[model samples]
Target: MSIDLQSKLTPLPRLYKEITLDVGGEAVHLIIRRPPRTVMAMLLSEARKAGELDEQDKPKDGGCAMRLMARMAASVLYAPDGVRPLYDRKNPEVIENLVENAEWLLDIQEDVVGALGANGAVVERIQGNSEATQT
Candidate 1:
């Protein structure tokens, strides 16, 4: 029996406008902005440069300074938390959580792009998974 996989495939769901926060809040709207490719490239380049710095010279945290900056920018755009630690040393668990979250975000991004029929860029596969399932 020849199964028509193309017919079986469904478009991924679009992201929701509002997200519920962990802290008490009614509704939070999402604003999607596509950062310029040049800006993203510059940020990645800076992160690579910062990663090369010696441990003593570098920030105490586990090479999260660049990521922290990006996260801070995102927070400012959405949540607006005034105080953010330069180095999050005590939170090893948080790093793991961030890694997981990053993976999720990447998958969502790829799905969105694929749904929109964009091509050429390579998509990274999720680690330790035999198959990709729709969420």
Candidate 2:
């Protein structure tokens, strides 16, 4: 028996997440969208561009890292409950917090890199250790 070509076709899996943060005793929510191929392409292109940053690329307040985090935050993030249009939440304080407390961000990066076949170790480690098991 031969395999059906249609049955062999599968779409790439995407992983989405909702991350919550506490700032000044208020809940801040982020609906983090998983990057599809197009978004990933844009990210890669932007990263390459970042490496060639000139003097003008620097923020006046010396917040290059915050700016980068803000850009990434803006790209994938859906606003919290009270916010609208997403851009409203991309402020300095919110962006600073995202850059400061970014454990989940690293996890997402590892997952994306693993899914893209760039970092086998991350997937392997997660699989081998069962780290993703939730209580």
The backbone clash count of each candidate, in order, is: 0, 0
Output the worst ten-in-a-row residue range by lDDT, candidate 2: 52-61
Off by more than 4 A, model 2? 1-15, 52-70, 80-135
Q: Against the hidden true structure, what lDDT does model 1 obtain?
A: 0.33
Q: Candidate 2 residues 30-124, lDDT tens each? A: 66554445643454345336552233332223344334434454555555442222542335566566557654554454333433442343233
Candidate 1 all-Cα RMSD: 15.9
lDDT of each residue in 34-82, candidate 1, tens digit only = 3333433343344446462232223224334434333322322222221
- The Cα local distance difference test for each model comes to 0.33, 0.44
What lDDT does candidate 2 reach at residue 119?
37
Best by lDDT: 2
**Candidate 1 Cα outliers beyond 4 Å, as residue runs:** 1-25, 52-135
In Å, residue 90's CA in model 1 sits off its true spot by 23
Q: Which candidate is the best by TM-score?
A: 2
